[model samples]
Target: MVGIVKYNMAKISGKVVSVLAKRGPGSGGTYPGHIFTKIGGQESISKLASDLKIGSVLITGTNGKTTTTTLLIKLMSNDIQIRKSYENNILNSIATALLTQKGDMGIFEYGIRNLTYGIPDTVQKLIDPIGVVYTTISQEHTQVAGIKNPFEDYYKAKKLLSEGMQRGAIVTNADDPRTALIGLNKASDVNINYYGIEVDNVEDIGGEDIECPKCGQPLSYSKHFLNHRGVYTCQCGFKRPEPDVKLVNAEFNTDSWKLTIEGDLFNYTTSQNVKFNVVLSVPPFGFHNIYNTLASITAYATFTPKVENIESTVKEIFNNLDMSFIPPGRFEVVDIGGKYVGLGQGDNGDAIKINAMFMNQFVDGPLEFIYTTPDENEEEIFNDHFEVVKSMNPAHVIVVPGRKSIEKAKEYYEIIKKEYPDAEFYPLSYDEMGVRIEKLTELARDSDYDYVIMTGCGEEQAMWEEIKKKMINR
Candidate 1:
């Protein structure tokens, strides 16, 4: 029941997304709206508070919230209406929401620390009066949350989502077992809209093949899209959602992706999952970008038909259509002194793990690899993740010596050395490392394969700043 003048609407994902393509002031054109109103909710909120202007959508979860929020806001913006801001994290979410409604509908992205982990009550209250977007429940930022058991912490965060917000607010992501278990209860009064990846595609390194949230049987994947998402069917006969809209037969082309509605099969790509093909998350960056793109876009498509021109519109939004990575980190190549250096970070953050979640796309290649371990600042690196790095058997790993470097970083390298004995170890201070890094980057810029990455660096923030400065001068 969101207040709508019903000026005009468009079709997307066939029939997904709606609402105001533009709102507030200064908002000119329209894109797709992913929110739906029952017809009375608007009045209800208005009655709840005359101050009630537009409800916000807080897309929070352990992973993909930022990227997903970015994509949703981007797709949600067409010629005129657009998302306001992309804040640093959940702590700043509310602040971003207040900036400029100017007639444009508000779509806020919130980040939660495990559950009730980092944010104070006031921030929680902010979400209370907004639209709810639960990205997914997974293990992340446990130290700050004080929940070593990531699942429980993540699950608790999901439950906490219901404290604020109206009845039956738009909620998606049926694939998350924790979602149905916790969110279903908190949002009991709210209408439920569910979307999941392929059931059989469940690769429960820790999060899939879960019992039916309702029926308690092994869920079957009607088709696994990507990650823990796809169509699901329970023995009790509840299927992943008929999906008024589906991201069928998603196709990823390394740098970009394409998606289509289900019925367009014979005319489109041969994948049976036609309705769910691959499309860039918005700006359409690299492979990792695809993960967040699918979730939010699919759900948005469900409620709003404004996403039809998504592929075409994305090009316009990206401004610079290059899938640029945050350089000196994650697949970075540089030219220093005419020598090529491939640089990348092997941070143990959970998002990097794509064993089952990512296949060929997350390849350990580019010919040469120069691994570097950073000083741990706050987040500690778990041993298991480093073991995977060792398994890669790169040419060399340089553990930077610094006060901020993680205590265990060197220890983990010790672990890798046991497996990769010949792996040259150059324990250099930041000054020498910086100069050497320059030389590597210079070569990487020139040669086909010179520099690769400085894996497992905890002091990356400090390093990235220095690198940025060097690039500017160069």
Candidate 2:
């Protein structure tokens, strides 16, 4: 009884903090939750989460968490009110949304770099989410906070997010074996709604092979959609799960993309079967976003109370969707006068490849690749990124420090110079991010090549988005 009183008081105080914090600098999205957790303790988070009548849904994975969460929020919001938070991927952010927003459901993007930084199991227990969405897992952040987080441990950390859930649904990418294995393992404990691409028109040109998550042996793939994500099978008999929601057909054009998606999944809120098929005309948002669309649609169909509104809601949201739905600093191809420059954050290998693939669509003539080198202790990322750079066959390559450590960038540049003897290197200081952004923007803008791609590793909003704004505004 006393604990209940304390929690109520904490909630009130958190709300007050949220109201006051918003009037000042910064978004203050996590401050109230930080204060509330400090005062009421971690145990209070479950009680706080219980405020949502329909419970919460958490979106997580390596690449598309923010975009998927944003789309899910839009789809769910049309059916019912939803408390949401994205870009900020922490418990405090979710807690702040719960404390400040009034809604029946909560949609939060929860990023897990590794177990050391993210308490996935604890978050699962406390949030007790009705839905947990996985947006394609890959090798990202090999080292977190100076600790070498192995792939096995990283995979385990992602699994722990949905490992303890007894109810609700697990919405995962069927094309990605890592996320598919998660669903297959949890099939008995909860509903698994898988989403993937079924069309043959979408295929990756070249990518490295990945090992089977179930067996140690290499997985055989008949088709490759994205890096490490495709239709595959293993000697251990583990293979891609049949998708409940899938892109059955797709028509990609320079101006727009037409996607025919079909879904037949169990709606958690209504405890009933729901199905829908809709063709959406969306901006040429790239192939990665196709997966994001399926993920968000599957998650929405799984949790939305208004199951009947699935098709209508999806069409209403996606058919009229714009490039603005993409999160800040994400990959986008911009037309500067007649020149085509594709720029944004491509931190990891998978992301860099995706950015390259997106940029490839716009590259007609000689393209200058303005590459950004990853920080120290990120050699693996550089190796993977280098592979993509070689594949692009750019007329020229420019290397810049995307993170701290100018020396490391130079080292990477020397390696690139071995391949392209004429490749240029810019030893820009990460401390002076503004100068770096300006240089990157200028390189893309004034380049002799009409086609330029400035992407690799960098701060998503601070560096990439700022550079994008400058190039577009100029």
Per-residue lDDT tens digits of candidate 2, residues 263-375?
Answer: 88899999999889999999998889999999999999999999988999999999889888888898899999999999999999999999999988888899899999888
Which candidate ranks first by lDDT, i.e. highest?
Answer: 2
Local error of candidate 1 at residue 200 (angstroms) = 9.9
The digit string of per-residue lDDT tens for model 1 on 73-188 reads 66665633634444345433233233223423456565566544554234445334344666666544334423353545556555566555454254556555545444455545
Q: After superposition, how far is residue 303 of candidate 1 from its true place, in Å?
A: 6.4
Off by over 4 Å in 2: 23-28
Clashes of 1: 90
Q: Estimate each model's TM-score.
A: 0.62, 0.98
Cα error, candidate 1, residue 437 (Å) = 7.2
Worst 10 residues of 1 by lDDT: 263-272
The true-versus-predicted C-alpha distance at residue 455 of model 1, in Å, is: 4.0
lDDT values, one for every candidate: 0.44, 0.90
